[model samples]
Target: MSDAYVALEGGSVVAARCRAPGTSHGELVFTTAYTGYEESLTDPSYEEQVLTFSYPLIGNYGVRSERFESGRVHPRAVVARELTDDVAEWLTEEGVPAVDRLDTRDLVGEIREGGAMKCGVSAGPDASPEDAKAALAECPGMSDYTDIGAQVSVSAQKTYPGDGDADTEVALVDCGAKESIVKSLVERGATVHVLPYDVSPGEVSDLAPDVLFISNGPGDPANFEAAESLVSEFVGEVPLAGICLGQQIIARALGGSTAKMDFGHRGVNQPVRDLRSEKVVMTTQNHGYTVADPGDLEVTQVNVNDDTPEGLESDDLRVLTRQYHPEANPGPNDTLGFFDDVLDMVDCRTPVAAD
Candidate 1:
């Protein structure tokens, strides 16, 4: 075992064992997901964040390419109580920093208490904890840092043919979206034109899509001015939807507001109750900020644990949004009906995304 250290923004450091050697910076955060390490590692939502796993034992199942959420790893670093050999090798091969024998229980507790903070990790097997803490001064804090959505979003327009009969035409604003989000739509035969984060109203209107989708992405939703601009142009004129950061954008566009969570939800099993269904279903979620108040909008769902807004809708604007991931790649599909509801709004005669 080599040396590794997690440095907090407050200038404290935790000593640990280094599985991969490197120095990296990100917002110090944790995920409660016990499985799906591969999906979590590649999820665009984890971008620029040093992830701490609450599951004490990790990587026992080994790495599998089929489970990847994206083409590559997204988290800046990995921390855990025990890192398996397979995960360590994969992290080392990918040039990502990772550490084990790190007191993750204490780390998660601290983060939960203080909220996510800008931090750095150095995994040199003989790294100095103090040195890592000192370097934290140079790293950008998550709140002040911008450019997160742009970093993960698509830069060009690409169209994918629907796997179904191609009845519904959908325009998706790729604000750092996950692959499953598109797959969920395309599987139902919806022609999807994936656009960039800064896509103009003209570009979207040119598609003449029956539905407009704003996707989940990293960083603060406030940083995504262009997405908000697009929302302003299309709201009330088109059937629109958003997820995660997309949900936050809709809130802002509709006169509501977003606020950073004390510690954002990043996990596979979150319970949210649908106001319409009166049923609580498990969901997947990842976001540092949440809609504090969904102004003038009907609250659709609420997180059972925290009472935070999980879903919002505006029948007037024909828009619906969920702050959790309903496309669930590595999570349960209980809330997949949200997508079916969106497709229904698209006038899809058939119930889609039911799987």
Candidate 2:
């Protein structure tokens, strides 16, 4: 007899043991990463979602705060085949629900076929399948969390100095930004000012940053109107860059459109090919939305598997964006050069001559 139950949107309930006791609801999703459990847990992009580990055994390596993408776990609940004492204890301390010792393969298969869907988890000595179902009944879809940015972004602007003698200035709009993204910019001789998602265009104009970078976040892209406004306000005036949700926002601001993916890309091994260079690289990704139309921006890179626009660029507008995380905290370093390409835009930030 198990003390935990996971209720899916289709009225199916799965029994499991309680690794961390609690009750929660979210969009059920999975990641195929075999490592970086700590980073995945703390990732802000996982906000409002129930994270399932497709890997057979999780927490083989102990949890470490240094590896975290954010200060706390963002997933509403966690599902796994097995959980180590270390991870279970960590999730418990964070007050996040967790359940394991179940058939993760079957759950992953369902998500793959049926797409990400509403889910609820009830885990504790007193938990019941009915409790899980009740949570699911009340759970809202991801698009409904319109103000999800407030749940993960920093309230006030925080600045991080670059390595000694930094030469560039970057104003990063934090729509649930990962710490690694900031660290990556700071390490590259760029003073990074992380602003809240709702920062006004005037405020950013006052800063007059060398570049404006939108960050990865959760929820629907249409909901982030402020970030999209920033992109429209600074398109040709300042170098613009974005990742994951950031990319979607950029495309939306540039007369493009975005749409929700079936299951989304949430792993460390997605392959992307640069259309211009004809070079392919394995990348890390975590977003439920993709740019269905690039608008004014040219599609410079695409996913090898699905041909989704992985990279969008506009030389005339001084803009560059990627649908995957180039900082790659818990994934590959193949795309880390993305930061360099961003800085190059700063060097080329001359005003376009009027026709």
Best by lDDT: 2
Q: For model 2, how does the per-residue alpha-carbon lDDT over 1-355 read when each residue is reduced to its tens digit?
A: 9999999998899999999999999999999999889988999999999999999899998988899899999999999999999999999999999999889999999999999999999999999999999999999999899899999999999999999796788999999999999999998989999999999887787777898999998999999998998788778888899999999999999999999999999999999999988999999999889999999999999999999999999999988999999998787999999998998888888532232
lDDT of candidate 1 over 66-157, digit per residue (tens): 88877888898999999899999999999999988967888999999999988978888558776577657668766565677778888899
TM-score of 2: 0.98
Q: In model 2, which runs have C-alpha deviations exceeding 4 angstroms? A: 350-355
Q: Which residue segments of model 1 deviate by more than 4 Å?
A: 348-355
Q: Over the full model, what C-alpha lDDT does candidate 2 score relative to the true structure?
A: 0.93
How far residue 12's Cα lies from its native spot in candidate 2, in Å, is 0.5
Q: Estimate each model's TM-score.
A: 0.95, 0.98
Q: List the residue pairs that clash in candidate 1.
A: 2-125, 3-125, 164-189
Consecutive 10-residue window with the lowest summed lDDT within model 2? 346-355
Q: In model 1, where is the ten-residue run with the lowest total lDDT?
A: 346-355
